[model samples]
Target: MQGISMSNTMQRRQFSVLACVFQSIFVALFAIFGEFHNHEEDKHNRVHANYPMFQDIHTMINDAGRSLVVHCFGAYFGLAAAKVCHRQNTMVVDDDESSGHSSELFAMLAKAACTTATFMLSSLADHLGRFNMAHIQSSSLAGGIAIGAFANVILYPHHAIVVGAAAALISVVGHPKILEKRLSIQDTCGAHSLHGLPSLLAGFLSALFVLLYEPSEYGPNFVEQYSAIYPQWKGSGQPGAHRDLRTQSFFQLAGLGLTFLTAIFGGLFCGWVMNWSLLNQVQPKPSYEDASYYLNAEFSLFGNIDNSGHGLGSSNTSIHKCGRIDYRPLDIEAALRAVKRAGIGPDAIF
Candidate 1:
């Protein structure tokens, strides 16, 4: 069982990496398509005319891929953090069986619907001023995460659309307030809304879906569609087994619970590790800053300068460029005295 679990973990990681690669490819193709589609409009459009297709490509890639990929990584870690309880009679569900036209429809429609809804819901942030652009941009993708577990199970296209829109609205509007006011936790990246809460919601929805599934929805191949639930109705020459709905629901809830526990404890432990003195010594002074992480940092022209012809030079060392300051070493001192004489006071320098 341990080996089996390890195998599953490796497989899931590989699958996630593959999905990210595909998302990048899709972003490139769609960006080019959008660029061509707007070629004529670009010539006449003054607004964002300078924004080229490369920017659009990155926007599409980040908007579409980041939230989804993050949700997947969080969910995987959450599940791995806890032990899952399964009924003895429960059947194994093959992950590959879920690929079909329904899956495609779910992906495309959910993305479109979520994108539209997020735009509308983000206005709430402007009014409340509780969050910033990170929340607005990333939290909107919660719709995709909310429908993740049951994406294929949604039979009607309209239902998927509704789910996506509703999820986006809830995430963008609720996440910041809850994090700031209720939890007293400031999620700098809005990960709680973009990945965690939406995923939990998706798991609950998936459980509801299992309870509400009907044979009439999928027709003759319905049993095969959910062979993991009804083991006894195996199609073709496959061995038959059976699982009751009640047990299925219990297992689903158990999985969700385990994931929650795992995520909480795992996160706490990781945070503790990050805060340790040993780790802190090696890291940059200020946390969550890009300056320390950059391989080649460029200093801005601001500050670290003096007009006295002697200052920190281009070689990062002090140099007397014009030697004018050496002749008048007290030039600045005299100026400050003059300012005081003029009644501006010492605070004038500040």
Candidate 2:
């Protein structure tokens, strides 16, 4: 069966700004995250201090540079769209109608950048001998994120709508691979955040950029603009000014939180019956066949469990080889089932 493929709703140009914005945000979070990922590699018990804020600034700047190349593809895509006639090619149409073309263009650019991120991530993972699908689950939402976040942005009027149409056609050239991923919008690893975040952000920002950059040239009629919504928030219609930093920041936070919550719930709901799949929880099997037991016995020796229930070592204040060695059976199935039922599992010693 043929699969569904999604594109972020934003135009190419506007995507640039949003990619910049989101790049900044991703860097901040990843700085902290990267340190955590590498925490085990410390040289000594004294622990090396990690500078999150400084690291975030540096990481984001580097990520932005790489992402910029992807944004250029979006620009080319937008330019092509301006030559064609497609909804995705609003820039061409908006430019003609004197609507918000600048904003739309920026949004498109940002979306293109994110699209590039998705493709690059896929390719880089493989190039480095890593699984290409590491972010497959995250890609769908990533697509949506790009599209949705930029939804509020406006587009330009193209004297020739064919530009957008052509751009859409070209972008679709890679549709097959994206469709094959079998991702859902709500999945944390879904293209929503991975793609949706950038797509939407691009789309909305493009709308704003389209109008902001060339309001007199392509902004909507005064009546139409006011009727749409948030007159003061028409970031595109009014150029040379930025949205309140605080408000924009709040929205960004909300966007991240929304995704985080959705990811948590989606993962739980979709895999409710499954447990310990991520190894967050340690559970044992119902029965241990000799083959399986021997195979996994040594493996779980250092497995982490929340509760060991070893009774605080009250065994005559003496440590035996058995006591010292955390050689205990793990009830993987039961523990998993219990977690599914109550979100709680038995704690083990090892």
| Best prediction by lDDT | 1
Off by over 4 Å in 2: 1-117, 128-131, 136-141, 156-223, 226-350
lDDT of 2 by residue, 25-128 (tens): 66556544433122332333242323323232122111111111133223233322222211222222222222255654554454543344443334333423
Candidate 2, residue 310: CA error in Å?
Answer: 44
lDDT accuracy of residue 324 in candidate 2: 24
- The estimated TM-scores of all candidates read 0.50, 0.25
- The TM-score that candidate 2 achieves is 0.25
Worst 10 residues of 2 by lDDT: 60-69
Show model 1 residue runs off by greater than 4 Å. Answer: 1-114, 128-132, 177-186, 228-240, 282-285, 295-350
Stretch of 10 with least lDDT, candidate 1: 56-65
